[model samples]
Target chain A: MRLLIVEDEADLRVALTMSLEEDGYVIDSAEDGEEGLYKAMNWDYDVIILDIMMPKMDGWDVLAELRKEKNTPVLILTARGAIDDRVKGLDLGSDDFLVKPFDMAELSARLRALIRRAAGKTSTVLTYRGLQLDTAKKTVSVDAIAVQLTALEYALVQFLLMHQDTVVSRTDLYEHLFNEDDDSLSNVLDVHVCNARRKLGGTYIKTRRGLGYTIGD
Target chain B: MNKYRSIRWQLMAWQRFLLAAVLITLLSLHYHLRRKSEIAEVDASLQSALMSVMPAVAPMMGRGGPPPYEPNSNAPPPRYEPDEENNPLIIAETYLEEIESNGYYVTSWDTEKGLMLSVGAVPASASLGNYELIVETPHFLTLNGNRELVVTHNTDLIIVIGRPLTDVNLALKKTRYQLLLVGSLVFLIGHIGGGIIIRRTLQPIREISQTAEEIARGDHSRRIELAAAPEELASLAQTLNNSFNHLDSALEAQIRFSADASHELRTPIAVIMAQTQAALKRDRSTEEYKTILQACLRAGIRMRTMADSLLELTRISGNGSVLNMALTNLSEVISSAVEEATQLSENHPLSFQTLENSRPVQIDPERIHQVLMNLISNAVKHNPDGCTIRISQKETAEWAILEIADEGTGIPVDALPHIFERFYRVDESRSRESGGSGLGLSIVKSIIETHGGTIEAASIPGQGTTFTIQLPLNPASDR
Candidate 1:
């Protein structure tokens, strides 16, 4: 999954990016509300972490503007513990909120939940035929046998299984699994797909010629 | 206690008490004075009756010869000699009859012969002593059947003349009744009227209290209606309104300060927590561990600096007891402060200018030094290296002025006024990296103010920024 972090504090922003990036997610960051809003409207991020206080514009204005154009899942990150701030953020169309000095584990877990809920998957586990993918554990298994997969391969498999029976185009897969900083000319996507097929079994994955990949009966 | 709860009620109670007392006193005075004058008139009439009867009775007492008798001045003489039936006694009886016809009871008692003559049927209960008592002064008495009487005595003839006081007493009784009725009516009317007037007069105060209650309940926009207030209460209302205005602004500032302080502290806390959490997630190289620990240390230092700034700000602004004042040379203090500040920032070019005739000013030297250090360091930090930071002092008749001007990138026009606000920064991202806790200017302003001084900032938004501080020369002496 891809995420956007919009925060003003430099050290906090860098720490959040580094920590969240380690949780098997592609991250894009903006230093202020204006840049954050611009990126949010232009990208297909699974979730956006917003900060309330910022320069150029505030998080509220950015969220209001972004809500007018997109339904991207938003989790507000604020230093204010005031209930009024929480209520206001939620009323302004934020999917979740986390106060500052929050545990990274909780933040990562909430992001995952938001992404899953946005994809219309109620459970943490996604299944395709006899293969099981546990999103929380970040692991995949074929017929009760665990298969070790790289972070990128696991992301690709999860995306395909989330859209089971539908062909996910290469462009959609790349947008979801990689951030803007990733090289577009790289053949990493095909290599990850081939590895997932070998590990999870060949019958569970299928690729539409001249289109994309799918997981179906 | 409940009755006095209302100011109008209390005012009415006191006023009605005074009114009732005044009315009763006047009414009693009128009643007593009227009764007194009526008794005097009755006594005068009794004395006059005595004067008239005395001459006629004297002739009857003499009886030396047939007393010259006249029956109407123009009538013919008596045809026969004065008979026993028509002697001087008959003449005396005629005079007595005249006095009796005028509501006077006349009686003559011969002390020598023990003879007594009475007319107008004086009540038996009238106290006419048998002894040879001669009281010439008139006096009052109540005869039987409660007839008020006035009586007087003559010494020579021992004649007593008495008059019933029925008419005088009746008139006085009526007047007393009327005075009581009128007094009661006046008291009732005055109290009712007074109550209404008092309530109306205090209506503005009630409104002011109601408005104050609403404001206390958090409706900050409400104010006392100055135009509608009574003249007596307008000043009070205005003063109360001024206090409310000040308190409202003070509370708003406190709330904003709390929010800013929390935000300032939370960022560093978040940085440390995030870095530590990320570092402990898995085993990492020694270099990675070193990097994470360094970031946490930086965050910790920032938090500590911010905490110290907040404490200093609170101590300076909270009260005046923290200031240790003394008489000292203003230029010397400025020189020492500049020397210390120069040592703190060697890259910045600092220049100090002082008045030639610098006088000793009353100030807290340590606090003044702190203020100078803060302002100088702020100039150094906000400006680029090698930018000129000038410190100058000037003296007026009653003021010692200090100006710290910087020739660096000035603050933006919008952020200039808020530069001294707690936790405010011109550029948040840049200032955080430069390790500015944002409370430097705030603490400086507090220290200056605590020393009975004023501070103002002027910025041209890219030209430069200048901070001018004015300290009173004798702050501790007169005040």
Candidate 2:
């Protein structure tokens, strides 16, 4: 999963980024609504966690402006747990709403749910041939035997598994596998993929020439 | 924003209604009574004149007297005589003198004497009691140019006496016009007087409302001055002043809460996030993992406590959480809270003085217990190891007071007033070490207030901090 966090509170923004990155989601953040809006216009993200109160502009205006061009899934966060703010955010095309002081687990679950729904994948369990990935349990089984994978390895394999029959480009793999917290301008995709393939078996993923990787029979 | 008519306007309307009803009724009564009395005086004089000539003519009529004073237009009219008392024509002559002297035109008639006529100011064509009415009274005569009063009574002869009504009608008309002018003047004066009175009466209320609006808009220092008003208005002003005082304090508290919420909650989030991110860049050894987890655990604990405190605040301020009042023993509540505190304490010893007596107080047991627990927890958290905390109680004439003294690093004098404010920490560094969210005192204050009690704190920079809480022994309902 890939996500963007647009929050005025720098501490909360950083904290949410680190926690979600630990859960294996590539996260990018903007300090204010203006920067957030600009980024949303240029980049594609699976889910956007938007903060309502921000400088330069507000989340409502950003949502309205973004909705004028795109239909990305948006999650709104507000300091005030007031229901009125929730109703307004939902009305303005927000997919989910969370108040401040949220737990890490809840944040991770909501992000996964938003990303899954956006990809039109209803079931939490994804299967390709004899390989099975349970997103809810975050476990993998190949031919009825358990397979152990690191958080990053699991996320990379799950992305390929979700795009079972399509070619996922290397650029797409890097965007989904890493977040801003990682040192930039480095190619770590090859190492993570070698590890994922080693654990899930080489036959489970097929690499397309000049494209990326996918999981198929 | 409210559309109701002003009290000033209502008062003015009522005054006008009362003045109009009373003034009009009294003026009409005076006019009718005065008119009747003046007409009666005129009739009495005319009847007396006929009586005066009766004794002289009473015997002459029985001795076969001829018809007297034939006003034959042929005998040029005779002049009146003042001393002609023995003459039967004296009555006619007397009226004739009045006519010539005072412009009192008169006409007399009798059964034996045919109609003896004079100048016809009224034409005398109709009998007595016939007069055209003008302005609700027959005191005016514009038609036939006859303004006179005709008075008739039978004595030895049928004497019909008439005095010209012009003067009476003019006098009564003058009175009517004077009355109208005076009544209007009174109404005008009353209108202005009532307006002034209403404005003066409602002036204080306007000032109170203006002050209230200012306070509502966040000018909490604004106040109503009651000393300048009269006793009645002063009471109303005093009530408003009291209400404004409470509202102003509540506004101040709300502002403090919001400020603390944003500023205090960010620090913990920053610490945890930075530590976690720095630790996650690469694989780490077990010792490094233990350090990172320990730091994260401290920050996480602070956030959890802060969230719990925030929830308690919301519950106290919100309408959904109402106090469930029940009779509770103070000793039991104190003991239960202390027992819980002992389990959570990090080696600090707590001492509770055994009460000489126990009283059942009307209170929400759970809320009171929460208050005790918060105070005890704060005591346990702030104090160093081996530092002692003493909890004791006393009874005043109207209150039961609880005293909790901590031998910890006391708060500064400047921060004492804000100790009970949400997320207010005297020493940020020290509180972070102890995982304090600075919301403990605020929760304690809220719970104490919900039980209709007051909590006060006194502390020196280094000696210690003592919290004195006074709960009413008799509930407000009992009082």
Candidate 3:
């Protein structure tokens, strides 16, 4: 995946670049808003991780500019965990948001989700094995039996299914479904998985011991 | 000084009244004692006169000799022929005349001759040797010595004996006039002295009062003069100056706090905006575009949270007394928060454990919920992968305690004290990564205090950290 990182902090940019590069993503970095915007407009990237605070132009303006020319998926990385910024960014055509100091695994997962979403592949009408997800109807079917899911559960299952056959870490799951800075507790992911498993049957999603969860055919 | 002018009248009036009362009392006492002494002198003189005259007159009356002329009597004599030709009688008469002229009258009675030996021109029918004597005149003398004499005594005798009274009266009148003049002078002097003394005494007080008034009107620098004033007034002035110093310090602190808060908020907002604009300036691949967008979103969220927290902290600090408290089911509140936190963290596991005897606590549920959310969120954001976060509740005898513990990079001991301070971040790099506003913990502390609760944080470097919140159970009922 090709991704662009726009951050003013040199250390943070280096850390993020190193982390994303390890995940097989071709990384391009910009130190400030002007350079980041120049790079974003010139290149075709699967996802963009833009910081809100920079020298010349801000994240909001960047998002607006990117949206003007393309419907490409964009993810905003900010140091703030505020609601209005998220709404504003999303309103300006941001695909998702990740607060700073985020884990490497979560950043990878969000990139994957944004890529899949940009390709118009975020759907639930497909299935692996006896599990089926119908995005149009907002329902999940297993072995031809309709399975009901809460909105959050459906999103969780869709995320799992999109990255099927791959180990999706808890941090990645959190970033995809929620923003960065989410409270890290052992039961939060467990509870959601428990709910999803209960509706879709436990065997469809496999827990990988200490690493994360995987869906397989 | 114009500052002291306002209280000048009040100070002067009080002093004048006090001095006038004291002076009037002293002058009145002086006059009263003087009058009493003069009356005493008159009584003593009257008693002495009566004592001397009564004793002298009683002995004369006891002797049975011819009645002696009083020497101060005046009476008309009866018509007597050859009274002047009788040379022997004339000489006796002349002696009588000399005595009579000296204010006396003499008479002698001869029982054999059936004639009264009269001198000093006594009345003809008047007898000098009779026990029952009726002079039948305006001026009559009963000698009480067997004689009767009609003698007109000068009515001015008492006047002559009291002749020294003129000198006394003149002295008394002079004294009275002097007393009137002196009393009036003393009263006037006392009033003026009293007014001057009172004004002098209250001068400092007036200055201090006016200084206080100016200070109250927002002139915080106003100070009263303490030099050369009375001890008490000096101390009062010093105290006032000290209070103004404190006020000035407080105002300075408030100004500093606002400036710092604004500075902190503006930097992050500006950075986010600038970075995003930089990102948008380039053309990129789908992945690059996505990454740029993600960075923008993150910065946007950070700015928003900072702004929100700043607002919350300001609100909490502005007024602390008004708390919207209600009966809250703490367990339910915790459960709901846990559920929301879990949903937000797609795969991160969260655990919840509660004591079986947990009960509802009275608090502003929303505020307490925010506190729990902040603590739990912090734990989650700071921890390493595969680390477990524990959310648990326990009840003590007096409080309900909720704890959020995380196995993460713990806080340094040096940073612990300042963790709850506004805009304080431990490990700035990591804090920026975690997208912290630095106001979360501060807001949590403020909310807990408002609910009459306590919160404490303990951490071990590279091990873990736990945030404990203890809320007073039934706080409303206790009150």
Candidate 4:
């Protein structure tokens, strides 16, 4: 899973980025609404956390501009807890609303839900063959037994299963599993896939010679 | 049923009272004049009857006939004799008979012959007595049950004529009833008409109150409609509407201030909370722990600065007595503030051009110093390193003027007016890095206002900005 944080406060933005990144999700952040909008317009993140008050452009204008082209789930994070602001944020096509000083755990849970829903999955547990992924618990199981996989390997498997019948390319994996700051080598995807195959068994994953990789038939 | 306290009801009450008083006065005057004229008619008839009957009664007075005819005299006496052909008794009875059938009581009394003649049935109450003949004058007398009689006396004979006052009394009675009926009708009509007029006149006031009530109930947009209001009420409604506009704007400003304050405080709090929670989630090396602690510390310091600024702003704005005013020279305060700024920002050039005879103005010296420092620091902070911050003082007859002008990249003209508002910033992103809590200008404006002064900012986008302050020479300070 990947997220974008558009906050004006430097410390809060940094803290949010570090904390969410530590939760095994890729995080990209912008300092103001202009850059946030620019990045949001170009990228395909699972969820965007927007702040209302910003310089150059406000979150409202950013959201309005973004909604013209995309249906990315948006969680409005603002210091204004007034009902009018909340109603306005929701009315402007925001998926969720959270006031400032919100709990990290709650934010993480909300982001997970947004990501899951964006992929058209109802339940947290995604299963194919004998492998099961619980999105809420951030855990994977094989035949009701726990499987130990690194955060990157877990994200790769989850993304592949989410796209299920289709083949996901290497570029798609890089965009979904890593943020802009990551300098992933061209062969890094193969290394992660090889390690995951060794842990979860070889038949659970398959790779097309030129296309990319897929988790199920 | 009583609306005595309302202007409409009171106006009607007063108007109806005056109308009733005038009606009563007019009716009574009419009744008085009518009664006088009716009684005059009865008295005139009585007097004429007496005069016509006097000749016939003279022969019966036993004075013989008349004095012998005298020539060459002022007057001559004609002969009057008692003969059967022109019989005195018959003539006297004929005159008496005419009066008797006409509802007049007639009585003639002769003292010398002890002769008393009466015609018609007079009431016992109206019987003539000898004492009534002592004077030769006509007098009005009330006979049986208020019937009026005219009594006339001659040198030797007394004649009494009485008439029933039914015609006079009936006419006056009719006049009285008419007065009452007309007065009552007029009063009823006036009451209803006056009530309607008053209500119509006061209708605008009622509408004004209703609109004001709606505004009081949180419909601040509502206003009294004045298109059809009367001139006096139109002016009143206009004044009330102006006040409502002012109050509405004031409340809106307060709400914006609170929202901005919360936003400013919440950001730092969120930073502290997120950093602490992240650090507590896992064990980190000493260097990582130090980084997280430093981040929390910075956020804490920012919050403290904001809290102090907010408290200072509130103290100055919430009350006038918080100012400690004294007589101080504006130039002296400016000189010290400029000196401090020179040390604080050595790279930025600061200059103070003071007037030679800077007059003493009544002000809060400490607050004024704070204002100077805040403005000077703003100039130093917003401008480039080598920009010149010029501080100067001038005086008018009534005010001492202080101008703090900066020669640097100025503020945009659109944001100048709102710069003094609490938590307002020219550039939010730059303001954060500049370490401004955003309450500095608001506090300065409040302090100046408490000292009966005005502050204004004029900015030329590329040239620079100048903050001009006008302090009263001898302030009627609020404190």
> By DockQ thresholds, what CAPRI class is model 1?
medium
- Give the Å shift of residue A39 in candidate 3: 22
Give me the chain B TM-score of candidate 2. Answer: 0.66
- Which structure among the candidates has the greatest lDDT? 4
The docking category that best describes candidate 3 is incorrect
For B371-460, candidate 3 gives per-residue lDDT tens digits of 878887787777646467788999988899999888878888888999988777775546766777778888889888877788999999
Name the lDDT of candidate 2.
0.70
Say which prediction, candidate 3 or candidate 4, comes out ahead on DockQ. Answer: 4
What are the per-model numbers of colliding residue pairs? 1, 4, 121, 0
**lDDT of each prediction vs. the true structure?**
0.78, 0.70, 0.65, 0.79
Per-residue lDDT of candidate 2, residues B327-430 (tens digit): 87777777887788777765767788746675778778888777777777776666656467778877877787888888877877777888887666666445
> What is the lDDT ranking, best to worst?
4, 1, 2, 3
How do the residues B1-479 of candidate 1 rate in per-residue lDDT, one tens digit apiece?
88788777778878998998899889989888897788777656555655555566444333321223232348643232223443323467654443433333334433322222333322223343433333456454545423223333432233444555567778988998899899989998998889888888888888988999999899998999869666779999989989999998989888888778887788888989999898888899999888888888999999999988888887779478887878888889889988888787767878999888888888888888888888877777777555788989898898999998988888888898898888788877778888889888888888888877899999887678899999998776456
Considering chain A alone, report the TM-score of candidate 2 relative to the true chain A: 0.89
Clash count, candidate 3: 121
TM-score of each: 0.81, 0.51, 0.46, 0.81
TM-score of chain B of each: 0.78, 0.66, 0.59, 0.76
Answer with 3 or 4, whichever has the higher TM-score.
4
Deviation in Å, model 4, residue A34 alpha carbon = 4.9
The alpha-carbon deviation from the true structure for residue A49 of candidate 4, after best TM-score superposition, in angstroms, is 2.4
lDDT of 2 at B308: 82
